[model samples]
Target: MKNVSADAINALKAQCRGEVLLRDDAGYEAARQIWNGMFDRLPGIIVRCVGTGDVIKAVNFGRDHELLISVKGGGHNSAGNAVCDDGLMIDLSLMRRVNVDPKKKTLRVDGGALLGDMDDESQLYGLAVSGGGIISHTGVGGLTLGGGFGWISRKHGLAIDNLISAEVVTSDGKLLTASAGENPELFWGLRGGGGNFGIVTSFVFKCVAIGPEVYSGLIVKKFEDAKEYIKFHRDYVRTLPDDMTVWMVVRHAPPLPFLPNEVHGKMVVVVPFVWLGNEAEGKAFIKPIQEATPSHGEAFGMNPWVGWQSGFDGLVGHGARNYWKSHHIKGLSDDCIDKIIAFGDTMPSPECEIFIPHMEGAPSHVPADETAFSYRETPFVLNIHTRWQNPSDDKRCIAWARDFHAATEPFAKGVYVNFLSEEGEGRVKEAYTEAVWERLVQVKQKYDPQNLFRMNQNIKP
Candidate 1:
């Protein structure tokens, strides 16, 4: 078998233009590593694709060789579906380029480009497509496919909402483009659909005018004020207009200087917001949040969008152990708030945090079935993220997150597949309802009947 695999690798080398890393290659070790340390799969080969042509060759080679295949964009998936065991791993990291057409206010991005890269390039023109949150390092592929959320989401919608078109490579090793006018069914599936249908090489997105600078910052309140802060948040968020978006977290406060020493490692509601308007208007919009509750200390000010993008840099990263669970709730009822606060108070690790962000904005107004994102009507989404630095603490962190989700699932209206772990097909189907699930299955069959794009939160074709 080893000899046969080696011969197949040689055959691929002769047909491909880019480099391929076998098990013994130095690059193989690096290529196999994903954002989540929990996954440690050793693929037979890691093909670092330099272009769409290389991607096509790699896909066909893997299919012909009967090897399991995984497509990695930014390699940021918590489930580590980016690489597989004893299969062909197609790494798209080298295809990082962004072409922004300022005149059309549109941007074309290589699927491997990170949100940070997209923001950095787009912001130069005082324009930005909707992108994932600050950790800017998140790949465009995973984020966009799984319904991206970030600072500008309130104004523009999910990252998928801004996607105008995409160039995808199908299972048959053919390059195809999908948009509203062409391959419309495939286009709909690409948005929030996860990477279940094809390999997206390039995506064209409609850019919106936004920050060179924006009024965005954070406010921290003590642990004792968790309930009050949440209550105030619920009401305050309801009143805020579409131009403002805020996400509140109750967690052990990181020991930043602005955070009082006594408050570190204690539960607190870290309220972060980005107001998309003039300073005066933005300040007016945020005034009530400050007056509504007694905050521990505030980090409020005007900053560049990139600075605001970096605000959560301390929170998100690759290589850390990631176990994520999430819920989309219709509202923050008292029972739900109590459950959240209870878990918040007993957070198992400093890195363990609960996120509840309002979803009732212009972005949320879109029909649930319009795209692959089906939970927009869900008023709030809660994320229980358990992140730790050491493998020894893995079980503890995962148990804490799972328990939190189990306790709160009764109040949850739906689940966000992007933040989910490998819970199996039933859970995947639950992420979309019977009707939506049926449609997704049909679309999956249409574009990828062989299920070649099953590497993601797979919807079986």
Candidate 2:
């Protein structure tokens, strides 16, 4: 990190339309804080960028001074790459703005905007964007760049498939547009390579006509039956239509109104699904899972898309200490099923759980080399979502997740970049195939030779 002089800092502050806070400033603490509480790094300076102009100014200042830059786009990465210790943090949370063009079947979202923000805008016109995260607060930038998958991903495609164009500011301080016909290679890299190439200012994604109301909710079963249900699901779900997507989870049961009082705080297997088409058809889609396991609780019917998207918000809200380990698996092999049940039965915390998102429809058809998300062919992704509220329980929670993840190593195809932590370069390499990694490196060298944007799942030049 370069020595940031007072005069240079003042110059940067004057150039932006937003606030710039030093480490000692009043709002600095809040500005530097990210989604996960486990990472406790303090930035030397925090710039609350309000728009593209602010982002440009901040990037130029950091580049000129060779300052270690950490960019924050809603700050929701589990790896805590949004902010870094002793660097200049470019905070884009305040730049959230969503524009919906219903007739064009497109939605343009600001780089810093959250999924909830985009949903609120697009849903107003009875339009929907595919491939948003389950949590509404997840930023459009990181999620989309890393091949975002949501309830509608199986039907529509990953967020990158819907991405028409991206407005970006490169390391050279020039703004550029990347799409199929413009900066095509950069476009491919951005789709799944993450925020390494540049600072994405805005993204225009192709939208699909989806439900203002659809069938979506959770069904709970005993934790002990997780392996059996998973075995049934691994085969049954492959037969389901693309309009319906199911993600299986095993964790301590929440005290939702549907669950029995005796089940509250007890371990359970949760099967949650969302159907993009008709309500009746959606209910029928998930019927097999309910029949496979003796359900302790079930809730399935027509519900607003906004409600379902934000459904998991309370459970994994910000400020919790979260450490996650994820793997793209071939299927629910016998060994994988056994390990999932083994880990699910002994969750360290109520919030700690396993998430197996099955995305094997439209997203998988895209050629692996076509985009930076090389693990597209994978059918099941296991995420050891380790979360806790207490500081003391961090070790136990993280250890359990690590052990579970390591135990399933033999069954993994590769790692998903989005669910990756600040793991070593070896693990990061696993996120991409050698061919894709080489291409990404070439793109990184062309756009960011100095590696200015190294905060994400970095593809170092």
Candidate 3:
């Protein structure tokens, strides 16, 4: 890309309603920082867009000036695609506004909105979207774009499956709306195609009926019983109904009151879940896990689903260096469970964890060709989340995750795109089938032929 002229830059600042920042600008540093601490790239320009109009100006400015471009929504992607060096960074953090229609059972969220922000607003009407990552502060744009899933996902499908429509600004600087009736192909690609098509300014989602509270929390067990517990969990989950979702975590026990002090900071298996039903039914549903293993600790109760979604926020908060390696497991073979426990026994950091999320039921019901998201047949996803402070521990934590991922590679068929880091194109291809990848490329060529939105898990035009 060619350098932007000073005169053109000044014109963009004058035209945009929001702030257009440069290197020496007061807020440039803060605007350019992303969730992943490892990336320290200094963008040449940063545009904090407050509304869709400002987004148009920024896109046009970058396009006309032939500058390298990047879009920063909530800046939570571990790959650091939200911001880049020597480029124009369009920061949408200020555009976080959510509007809910109770009559229609839908929500329209701005691109800059965080998952928690959406939840806070939507839950007021006893309506919810099947969204949010473990960290509530994650951006809605990236998460939904890459096939969102959570505790509720097993019951109601992924966020992309519930997405009804979206407003996007293409590389040509033209605003377009995508839905089933208009730009159908674009809508299909946007389901799990990442940010390659365009800058999505807003999303319209079909909400599900949910209460203020649900049965949710964790069941902790000692490391010694992990093998038997995993075996039981593997079989038990298959028998569970769609409304009950459970995932496993292997990590050192925190100083929560439920656990005995003797078990604090020791290896433990935690089974966290959300039951979308009455407390009586939930208790019965969760009883089998407790019976299967003599739990060292347990914490389960009826809680607010909206608030419970962000329960892991403090563990994976902002400014921590995070590297994640993940896979879509077909089934939990004895060998696979043993390998997971072997590496999890020696977790390198307190912040790191071995996450085994159940991805069955509702998400699998979506036909493979209906959306860009593949791997619908997958039952589980193992995320080796490596998060730690201190730049010195980066090598140690990252190596552990990679080695663990390699050990379990044979058991996985594909991968969940959202959990992937900056692995290359081969890994990206693994996230989709040949047909879906080709369809994405066609959509890319139609909307962003010049590849201006190549900062994400890119689909080449």
Cα RMSD of all models vs. native, in order, equals 1.5, 1.1, 1.2
* Candidate 3: tens digits of C-alpha lDDT, residues 106-145: 9999999999988999999998898556678999999999
lDDT of candidate 2 over 211-262, digit per residue (tens) = 6888888889877677778888899988888887888888889898999899
| Model 3 spans with C-alpha error above 4 angstroms | none
Worst 10 residues of 2 by lDDT: 276-285
* Candidate-wise lDDT, in order: 0.83, 0.89, 0.89
TM-score of each: 0.97, 0.98, 0.98
The order by descending lDDT is 3, 2, 1
Q: Report how far off residue 228 is in candidate 1 (Å).
A: 1.3
Q: Clashing pairs in model 2?
A: none
Deviation (Å) of 25 in candidate 1: 0.5
Per-structure clash totals for the candidates: 0, 0, 0
Local lDDT at 123 for model 3: 92
lDDT of 3: 0.89
